[model samples]
Target: MKDVPVYTKSQLALRNGQDKPQIWIAFKGVIYDVTDSRLWKNGKHYEHWAGQDLTLELKDAPHSSSVFERFKVIGILG
Candidate 1:
């Protein structure tokens, strides 16, 4: 089996949203759901992934290469 790659916060930011089912996002080796996470403003990260929103984010989190390898398109709220 191939090992999953990790990504940084800034790296994951590149693929905020796309038409894909899930986009992997790694923070400290732990992946998160960024699909429904708000990316419009700063300091609101916690609020977006506090409840059901996390489920969406987790579902969208990528499972392929790291952000450095390719761009994982995700959904961003306006």
Candidate 2:
């Protein structure tokens, strides 16, 4: 398998739709590309925003973290 990329919080922030068209969210150190996800349009999902770690926030979400497994794994947060 290829090595997964690593990104810092500042680096991930640049991918936010407001700063850039790409949308990224991190959970448990894994970053997912949610740019194509209808739910993440404009980098906002309910109270969550792209380019930030959602590890702690998932507890408040209705769905489990498995929901993110379907999305593309872009990198890991370092």
Candidate 3:
């Protein structure tokens, strides 16, 4: 199996849609690119923002972790 890359929070911060156009979010130590997700346009989904870990915040969300099934796993958060 190919080893996935690990990124630091500082490096991840730059990927916010506004800062670098990547629009990424982290959950359970996994980073996902949400740039093409309509719900994540401008890096804001409801009250959630991109370029940060959403591990705890997602618990109150209307959906479950399954919502991440379709998004690609870009890396692991370090």
The lDDT per prediction is 0.38, 0.92, 0.92
Q: Write the per-residue lDDT of candidate 2 for residues 1-78, one digit (tens) a residue.
A: 169988999999999999989999999998899999999999999999899999999999999988987999998999
lDDT of 3 by residue, 1-78 (tens): 159899999988999898898999999999999999999999899988899999999889999999998999999998
TM-score of 3: 0.95
What are the TM-scores, per candidate, against the unseen true structure? 0.27, 0.95, 0.95
Worst window of 10 by summed lDDT in candidate 1: 43-52
Cα displacement (angstroms), candidate 2, residue 20, comes to 0.9
- How do all the candidates rank in terms of lDDT, highest first? 3, 2, 1
